[model samples]
Target: MDQGLAGLIGAVVGITGALGAAYLAGRGQREQWRVQLRRDTYGQFLARTKRAERAGKAVRLAMDSGRFEPGLYATFAAAVAEAEESLALVLLEGPWSVASSAEDVVRHLDGWRWVVELWYDGDGTLTLERALESAGRDEDRFTQELEQFTNEVRRLLHGRDHTLTARLAYRLAARHSA
Candidate 1:
């Protein structure tokens, strides 16, 4: 090949490679940002839920055992409210499945709250023991849903496609794994 032609071809190849690398790097950075956002959102959600759970447990323990702790109910109520508010973050940053799971968790929180209010006195048909049992079950369900949501977020972070088709495939695979 002519020297000039060879040099020109080499320059074009170099420029193309550089542009391709830049494009790939930009894509990688974008993915990283998405992963970080998800991590932060999930972390906040987990923290809020844990706070609410702990408070709820304390109140339930007091109610069930007839302790009548002065601030337990108030603390639990505040924590539950905080947890509910944190759902906005999940809704904003999370995938639909995660948002749905978070919503389910919030529903369980509401149920737990209702049980605490209705039967905390131990006078209703719903006894304190029954309420406690119900709360335990609700917690179990919430935990499971939270686990699934967390797993979904992890999968997304690890480069699982976020398209609906990919979600269906992932869910199906997850079901098989389970």
Candidate 2:
């Protein structure tokens, strides 16, 4: 074999190897966005749930203080809306179960929104204590369902690991008294 030809062949093989390496690296890098998105979706889910819970608390506090301010209450209502949007996006993005779970999130946020709105804009028709009681009950039910929904998402995404569920619980628990 000619020495020059051998060297040429060796160079080609080296170039091909480099290209293959680059291709694989690019593939892995692409998945980095997926991993980050998944993380963001989960983080948003937790944040939204916590925000909804806080909004409910705010409603209770406002009613107790007898302060009727629609704009102030709207902030909490807006959080519920933001939470709904995040859930919707998560459903649209991936892992399939986001659809079902995100629906649950939307439903819960919707019900919770009323309570926030009631705090500021509710007519004198219904008794504050009664309405607050009803909202609290709804929150309890939705919280249970949200836990289940997120658990399902976690099960689908993480298999046996319950990291998503745990994080959500930790956030809710931390804010329980708040």
Candidate 3:
């Protein structure tokens, strides 16, 4: 073969290899960005839901104590609204399973809110004990749904290594709490 032809062929191969590598690297980076985006969205949703749960607890406690604190109820309603807003993002970033679980959590929160509203407006028709019991059931279901959502997120983010991811997440949570 001619020397010039040989050099041209070598250059073409090198250029092709470089281009392929660059393309692969770009693809990897884009995937990483997407995963990060999803993680952020999921975290926001979880945080908002937790806030709503805490607010609900506060409202329930006040109600149980025979205190009709309208401010607490307002706070709880605001928190639930924030959580619902976050749910839209979760749904947008979801793989269906995670979104579905998130939806369940929101639904339970909404149910709890309705229970609170009914109890407040019951005017003695709805007993406090009955309302508390209903709220407890709603909370339990919400917690289970939240756990399912977390598991789905872990499976999606960490694939088959969810146990390891769970441990890491726990550690991070513990660290942050401290």
The numbered model that scores best in lDDT is: 3
Best by TM-score: 3
What ranking emerges by TM-score with the best candidate at the front?
A: 3, 1, 2
| Model 1 lDDT at residue 42 | 80
Q: What lDDT does the true structure give each of the candidates?
A: 0.75, 0.72, 0.87
lDDT of 3 at 37: 99
In model 3, the number of clashes is 0
| Predicted structure 1, TM vs. truth | 0.74
lDDT of 3 by residue, 1-178 (tens): 9999999999999999999999999999999999999999999998998889888988888888888698888898899999999999999888899899999999999999888888887687878899999998998888777777887898898885365555566457535633
Off by over 4 Å in 3: 122-124, 161-178
Instruction: Report the Cα lDDT for residue 11, model 3.
Output: 100
**Candidate 2's error at 20, in angstroms?**
1.7
